[model samples]
Target chain A: MKEHVHHLKDEEVNILLNDLLEQYGYDFTDYSFASVKRRLQRVYINDRFPSFAEFRYRVIRDSTYLTYLMEQITVNVTEMFRDPAFFQALRKQVLPVLATYPFIRIWHAGCSTGEEVYSMAILLQEMNLLHKSVIYATDINESVLEKARKGIFPLAYMQQYSQNYLQSGGQHDFSRYYAANYEYAKFSESLSEKIIFAAHNLVTDRSFNEFQLIICRNVLIYFNKDLQDKVLHLFSESLEQLGFLALGAKETLRFTTVAPLFKPLAQKEKIWRKIAT
Target chain B: MTVSLPRTLVIGGSAGSLDVLLQLLPSLDPACRLAIIIVLHRKSDNETLLSDLLATRSVLPVKEAEEKDLLRPGMVYVAPADYHLLIEPDGTLTLDYSEKVHYSRPSIDVTFSAAAEVFKERLACLLLSGANTDGADGLQMVQAMGGVTAVQDPGEAEVAFMPRHAMTVMQVDRVLKQKEMAEWVMSL
Candidate 1:
C-alpha cells in the first residue's frame, strides 16, 4: 500500500461549494455535484495544496484565486463546429427559418471562449444574414469572453476546425475566414462585428432578451436536473415564439419542463422548436 | 449475497476487449455489492449500443453512464462515448467533454485516475486487451493510492499492449486469465 497525499473529503467539497455561494454569491450549488467535485479535486490537487483547510482558506481570502478557481471548475473545453452535424442542421434546417425574420438574434448561453458563437457567425455570414444577425455570446467567465471577443485562436486548431466547417456544410475555403500570423489565427473583423461578448452567469443571470434561436450546447450537462430544468426554462422564456433551441448531442428537452413547449426540430441533431404559444 | 458495498471495480480496455466483456459480464455475481464500471474507448457518434448489448448478456441492470448519476451496487455503468467518465468522492459519476487524453475521449487514464483518487483502497482497477498505452500511468496511480490493480495476462489477451504496459509501470495485484477475470472481480 502506497502513502496517500491530501485527498479532499466529500464534506470538504460541500464546504467549498457553500463558501462559493456565500462569499461570492456564485451559485454552483445546483451543478451536477459529481463532475463539480471531480473538477474541484483536480484544482486542489494540481496546485499541490498540502491540506484541505489551507486550500479552503486560500479560496475564501484571495479574490483573484477565487476567480481562478471558478474558471478551473467550469468545463471550458469547446471547439469550433463541435459535433458538426448539429451545425449542419443549423445551416440546413434552422437558419433558413431565422433568415425569414427581418433581424436575427441568437443567444449563445454559456458560450465559453466563443468557438461555437464564431461558428454561428460564419454560418450567418454565408447565408448573407450577417447584416441582420446580432450574436449575443455570453459566458460566466469574463476571461473566456475576453478571448472570444478577440477572435484569435491557436493556428494549430485551424486545420481541425476547418475540417469541422466542411463537415458542417461549409463551401468556401475555410481559411478565407481568418488570417494566420505566427501561431495564432485572427478571425476577420467582419465576423466579429455582429457578435457581442458579455459576462452572464447562467445560475444567477436573468434573460436580457428574446431570440429567434438559442444555442446552449454541452452547457446544461454540467448542471444537475433541477438546474438543467431551471436553465431550460430560462431558455424557453428567452426564445421568441416559434424559435428554435439547440442543445449538446447528449442533452435533451425530453423529461424536462421545457419539453412540453418544444418539439424536436431535428431530433438526432438535438434541435427543438418552441411551439408558438 | 452480502458482499461489501461501495467497492468500485473499474475495468478499462480498447480493442479486442469487448469479447472479454461479453463473456465476463454474464458470469458476474448477480447480487455482487459493487459498482461495476466499464470504460471502453468507443466511437463518439450514434450506435452506442455497448451498454445495451452488455445488459442483454448479464443478469444485472446495465446502462449508459449519465451526468450526475449516483453509483449503485449490483449494477453496471458503461462509460458513454465521446466523454470522459470521472468518479467523485461522493460515489456519483460525472461526464466531461474535455480534450481527448492520449487521443481518446473516454480515455482509460482519465477515468482510472479519477476512480483511484476517489475510491482509494476500496477501488480495484483491471486493465485488459488494448493496442494503446493510455492506461499504464493510470494503473500506476491506482496502485500508488493503495487500491488493487489487475491486468489481463498479456499472453492470453488478443491485443496485449495495454495490459503489458500496465505491468511495466507498477506491480499489479493480479494478472488474470480471461477465465479468471470474472471470478477475480467477484472475489473482490
Candidate 2:
C-alpha cells in the first residue's frame, strides 16, 4: 500500500469548487470543506483521476463531467415521516401555536425531494391549516427542487412510509395522499397547491418572506460552524416574531448565537419558538 | 495472466467509532488485498476529520468514497455524513437519494445491503460498535449472498447492541476483538 499525502489541500479544493459554482451558478462554495472534499474525492475516484488537479481540469474542460458531478453532489437523500417522533411532537406541541394564526407562511428549508414538505402539508391539511397556509420549499439543488415540485417517489417505499405516517398520528389513509401507477407514486397536486418549490442557496440567497414556521431538518449538519451560523441567522431573519423553528432530532441551536434568540418548545425534538422582540 | 477479482469490505459503526477505527486501521496488514468502505454516523453539518485523521494512522490509502469512483485494492473509503453510498457492479461508487434506512442517510444497512447485491461473494461485511442495531439485517443479507460476515465481540465493542443483534440474527464467521479482527481480515 502506498501513502497518499494530503494531495487535495483545502484552499485548492475551495478554488476549484468555487470556480465550478461561479461558472455554473450552483453555489456550493459555502458548504463545509469536509463535504466539498468528500464529494470531490468521489468525483475524482469515479473518473479514475489520480489527483485533484486532473479532476479539476476535467471538470473545467468537460461540460458533461461537470453536469455528472453536479448530480452526484446535489442529490438529496430524504424519506417520508423521517424522524417520526419530531412529527409527533410537532402535532402535539407546535400545531396548537400554528392553529392560533388565521393565516400562516411556512418555509421548509433544504426540503430535498419534498418528503418533509409534503409531510408538513399533510399535517397542516389534517388540522384544517392547509387551506390557510402557504408553503415555500427551498433547496440549493435544482434537481431535487424539480423532484420536490413533481411530488413523486418510488412506490416500493410507500409501505414503510405508511407505517411511519400512522405512527406520527396521521388522520387519513396514507394511500389517500398519492396515486400509484406502476413503480411511481404521484402525490395529489392538491397537496402541493399551496407549495412553491424554488431553488434557493442558503449561502448566497436572502430570505424572501416572513414565515410563521421554519422547518429545516437534517440539512444544516452538512455545513461548517460558520456556515451554520450564517444559515441560522437567515432563518432568524426569515421568521416572524414569536414564530416557530424546527430542526432535525439530532440538530440543535444550543451552541450557536441563535440559541439565545429562540426558546425551546420541545428540547428533545429540537422545536423552538423565536423570542418576541 | 488473469487478474484476480478484488474483494470489498463494508463496515458500519456509530457513537464510538473514532477510537475503534484508530485502533483497527493501524493494525491492518499493508498487503491486504481488499478495499474497505466504512459508514460512521456523524453530524451532517460538521467537518469530518476522519479521512485526515485515519490517513495518518493507516498505510492503506484512505479516502472518502465519491460518486462513480471504481473500487481499488488496499483503499479505505468512508461515507460522507449525509449521503447514501452505494457500490455499482463495476466496483464504482454511486450516490443516491434512496430514502433513509434505520433513520439515517449514510446508513450502515443501506451501504451494506447495496454492496451485498452488487458484489456478492467478493464482499466482506463487518458490524462494529454502534448505538443501534442498524446493520444486523444487512450483514445477514451479505452472508446470505455468500459473502463473509464478521462481528466485533460485544464485550469488546464500544456500544454492544449492534454487534450483539448481528450475532443473534446471523451466524457470523468470526467474533473477534478489534485487533484480532483486523488480523483476521488481513489474513483472508
Per-model TM-score, in order, reads 0.90, 0.63
Error of 1 at A112 (Å): 0.6
List fnat, each candidate. Answer: 0.47, 0.11
lDDT of candidate model 2 versus the reference:
0.79
Candidate 1: residue A228 Cα off by (Å): 1.1
**What is the docking quality class of candidate 1?**
acceptable
For residues B98-121, could you state the per-residue lDDT of candidate 2 as single tens digits?
446687868887788777766779
Best DockQ among the predictions, by candidate number: 1
> DockQ for each of the predicted structures, in order?
0.46, 0.08
**Model 1 lDDT per residue over B24-69, tens place:** 9998888798899999987776556888899999878999997767
Off by over 4 Å in 1: A1-3, B1-8, B26-35, B49-62, B68-75, B88-92, B116-123, B131-133, B136-148
Q: Assess candidate 2 and give its TM-score to the true structure.
A: 0.63
